[model samples]
Target: MATVVPPDLELFLTGWLRSNITDVDGLQVGHRTPDGYDGSYPLIVVRDDGGAQSADRVVFDRSVGVNVCGWTRNSPKDCRDLAARVYGLLTGEPDILVGFAEGSSVCAVVPDGCNGPYPVTEDAPYCRYYMTVEYSAAGIRQS
Candidate 1:
């Protein structure tokens, strides 16, 4: 008997990572899990804002490998403060264009990461939690 087969999970995950990390520069997501839930974890980077395990509370670990560094949420006045920190590493005043789902009203920097006078929303989804997952499990146990 032949059972229904779902689409390639790896491909889907890969695509998801790429789409999510669009805000980061020169950053690309990858997967190397043998078997697990989706099998992926964006890169790790120092962060101050976070929410959920993934779509919620998140924090930075200052340790990760090649992956998508999560987003930041510093200062209530604007969300770009965190992004500004991330992009700041690249540009003195980064005016990044973070596009959601490849290209969807690509958000712009507020006034920290970029040289924007007054923008709205962060470029990418709040990735503080997503970035926390990206780590080097090569030395850790699976179970």
Candidate 2:
């Protein structure tokens, strides 16, 4: 069966990331992932990676990943700090409204995997961190 992208994953994740992930000033969240920062420290970019459907094709699950980056000159730990926090907040988060589902509240957000606070460049004065987050919702698709 063909997999269908969850309709509300992006919409729900944008607000979720802004409110829960980017909790500090000078931190910014956007849809596009930048190769370098635009004066925004602790930057988070959310993107729709991929998704899947249940074996019976009734439920949809999607993966939305984020790239968190921070400057690494004076305070060299910000990127990892933000990455750890984002991971903590996302794992096992329940009851998020995935609007495509029929149940009143039927969704869970969890960490799929994680990658560095590794240097963005050998000497670019920045650190890069990435995490793949999975959003799963089981419901009857709206006709």
Candidate 3:
């Protein structure tokens, strides 16, 4: 029997991206992968969201869209790289918010039985996503 080598999807894609995007600057990543869930694609939102934060706000300038689909998977490196990019776009700020995202329109891709209308909340829980950056640094109201 021929030995089947497990392919490292993240590593492969990371290498390929690094080799191609030469002009880009610093990058970081944040991931929120769901366990035992299969049906919808993972949400990957990459962008520059770093700036002056307060006791209640966070501002962002630019956000990149990393919509993975058609059998595309994510990795830890992907999360870090995404955060780095967001930082670079905002002048390399370490205080970055790297996590999942979901707007008022889009619903998270979940299982069949556990699927339904998206909840009515501001901080939408995203499973296996990098980010949802803004173009300019803004503030958040943690009130």
Best by lDDT: 2
What tens digits encode model 2's per-residue C-alpha lDDT throughout 51-79? 77778665667676777776764465777
lDDT of 3: 0.29
By summed lDDT, which 10 consecutive residues of candidate 1 come out lowest? 132-141
**Which pairs clash in the backbone of model 2?**
none
Give the per-residue Cα lDDT of candidate 1 at 28.
40
Predicted structure 3, TM vs. truth: 0.23
Tens digit of lDDT per residue, candidate 3, span 1-143?
Answer: 33222222233223333443455334222232335334143233222222323333333222323321112233334434443443343222344212211111111211222211121122333223222323332232332
Across residues 42-138, which tens digit of lDDT does each residue of candidate 1 receive?
3423222211122221221112111223333332222334334434432222333222233222122223222321233444433332222121111
Q: Tally clashes: model 3.
A: 29
**Which has the better TM-score: candidate 1, or candidate 3?**
1
Q: Sort the predicted structures by TM-score, highest score first.
A: 2, 1, 3
lDDT of 1 at 80: 38
User: What does the lDDT read for residue 119 in candidate 2?
Assistant: 36
TM-score of 2: 0.67
